[model samples]
Target chain A: MATEIVFYDIPSSLPNKAWSPNTLKTRYALNYKGLAYKTVWVEYPDIESVCRQIGAAPTRNKPDGRPHFTLPMIHDPSTGATIADSAKIAAYVDATYPDRPSLMPAGTVGLHRAFEDAAHPLIGPIYPYCLPASHALLNPVSAAYFRRTREELWGKTLENLTPAGDADRVEWKKLEDGFGKMDEWIRASGEGSKYLMGDVLCYADMWMAAYLLWLKLVLPGRWGEIASWHGGRWGTLLQNLEKYETVL
Target chain B: MATEIVFYDIPSSLPNKAWSPNTLKTRYALNYKGLAYKTVWVEYPDIESVCRQIGAAPTRNKPDGRPHFTLPMIHDPSTGATIADSAKIAAYVDATYPDRPSLMPAGTVGLHRAFEDAAHPLIGPIYPYCLPASHALLNPVSAAYFRRTREELWGKTLENLTPAGDADRVEWKKLEDGFGKMDEWIRASGEGSKYLMGDVLCYADMWMAAYLLWLKLVLPGRWGEIASWHGGRWGTLLQNLEKYETVL
Candidate 1:
């Protein structure tokens, strides 16, 4: 019998038990591949210790130059491998479980990576608006940890992280323009295109859908606005990937 | 006989008769597709006039808001279509021919565009060094025009556009790192991968090879130096696509 993969995720106080887009991407990948995985919930403060105990390497060095551990790691007993980072986890699952459908189609792993890199500008501008909202959703312990970490990065209070009032709209508009450019490129798929690669749902779609889901969870009103932009393309994307939104 | 596509190019006094990476990209598409085409060389000063005369739409507006005409345009008499811009031209050729090996394969056009967008930072950082070298290769009329125009954009003389000495090396290193990141992403292609789409050639590969070829043309010394970076990946890529480097 194949052992269940041990997936690690951060718990949000939200009833759905998911919030971080980073971990949501992995959850979607596991569910889409029909992999049996049991979630191990970790708190913001314990990420480094949990990752260290399990032997999953840190994803990157923090701004302070220390190894920075992150959630959305997986320990696959099937291969006795411990992988960290959503992207690496996706690749590992796809490569190990060849019988299942691949999130990255043949010869497209690089293109998928490129799409995600290009997508950073699309998703990044929305971060300031999302941070305060996201910090609000965390439990007390994580809320404090999240605020301190993020505030340190920006050198400001969480409340001041994003521009307020009309300025926020201008900032939000930048994201809209970014999405419009992305939509323009993807529309080269011609009409009725729902995903980046047209019909098949690749890792890039999972990455995108994960962020769309994050916005829906934390910033509902703004999420509603996003749905109207780009001809409801994003709304339709979330709808299509609804099956993989399973919280388990 | 089918009417030939009119390919617009900016000529360099270099023995090869091709210098601009932008134009080289379109030329690669024409050759790669085995399309019938003839070059209509447009000097730097003549670009806007030639584009206006042919009714090829201006690619974009200039800093002062006037329509900015740039090259690598194609006028297909067979279809009576005038396409401007390298990417759009590449798309038009692939879409119009229908019989040639597609530069963009099924379901990959959007991915190709995304890859190109992600590639800009990689290609852009190298431009400062290449500009003066490129101007040196242009004929006097084009050289004067190129200097005046680019100086207007940078508010600096052609010779002063790029950093010199140790500073230039530092600036050049930024490009090396950008290419390294791209190589890292594409290395997801796993072992023995030759192109962005693994074994098959795609527009992204052509897009990259065009710049690689451009660097080789104007900056032979630095080009030779680049061959050693990223395990000779750029060099090998150019070597693999050598067949399509033909000047027509």
Candidate 2:
């Protein structure tokens, strides 16, 4: 039997639903490597129990002293290794499946990590713009859990976080500006590069592509507009990853 | 005779001086490639005149309508090409001398640019903390010009920019936090990696090493403190680049 990797993901109310940027990274890696993997759906509230059962580490400690667990964890039944955290899972998968197509090109792990680190702060301002739309897509149970937990974390209700009217435009402008900078950076790399890492897509591209997918999923209506904002560059890049789409 | 590249740099008063992170990237690239190059010192007031004489385009247009100019421009007498931006210069050099050690490996330019873009913002907050010390190390003419131009740009005097007191500590804390995040990202790349792109040093590493060198030139005392701040991992990385240090 082919080795099976059990991928964990958060499910939404919408049919054919799976959207969590972090977990999507692992999924993309698995798909890119052509590894045989089966995804196990876990709700927002069950992340802790699911991760704990698989022996995955806590992402962080919560305010109430409980360990904050996150999804995108995976179990490699063949190796009996369960890895949590998207980056960790990526590194583990890449190292174990050396002969498979590489997610991180040789000698780029650190550089890629720095790139992700740099882009991470930009992701923060986008949350306010995305959270409300994302809330609507979550299952009733997941939506309630997501709303309450995120409200406590953000110190604002979802609706209040991204209120309609001029406020939404203002928040969206911030996200657009951030992505604009990214576009400029990509262009500055000169004519040869199509993806963030150039012609061939690497883990860094996966990081971005997965996030773009998540953005499209949660805010289906606004994505086409936002994707077209940077001269349709981001949307085009997302389309480039279509070949790697694996049936879940 | 082998073609010698003309490297332009900002002048300082201190002996054995070197500054300007952008140009430092070019210098590191040349050194890594073991290329023959001669330094052409340009003071703050003379950069525009020199670059214009060399036919290098202005970096950007200023708010007041004057063409904005910056350092690290290069003159390739052999090809009669004078590139203005450090990134462009690096690309030109890496391409012209294809067999030399690459500043950027093939198919990685766009990814590297994203990495550089991500780290660029962190460099901004450190300037306020370093500008005063940097001013002290500049030559008389350069120092006076630096002070006046920077004061105008910042809308505050250098003395006021880095005030001595608890306030400085607060500013420093912010810088440290930025670097701390970088350190975390580096550690996340797994065990085998050393430089930003893993064991092999690349353009991104040069970008950082050059900045660290500037920090040392501007604030010698703080460089050691800051280098050691992140458990000396940064210091070790800087040391790793020592062999690539070319004598100008």
| Top-scoring candidate (TM-score) | 1
Residue B87 lDDT in candidate 1: 85
Q: What is the per-residue lDDT of model 1 for residues A167-212, given as tens digits with 9 covering 90 to 100?
A: 8788888888888877877687667777777888888888888888
Candidate 1 chain B weakest ten by summed lDDT: B185-194
- Error of model 2, residue B47, in angstroms: 1.0
Per-residue lDDT tens digits for candidate 2, residues A122-178, read: 666767766787788887888899999899998988878875688767767777787
Each candidate's number of clashing pairs is 0, 2
Q: Label model 1 with its docking quality class.
A: medium
Chain A only: TM-score of every candidate? 0.96, 0.93
- The deviation in Å at residue B163 for candidate 1 is 1.3
| Candidate 1 segments exceeding 4 Å error | none
Best by DockQ: 1
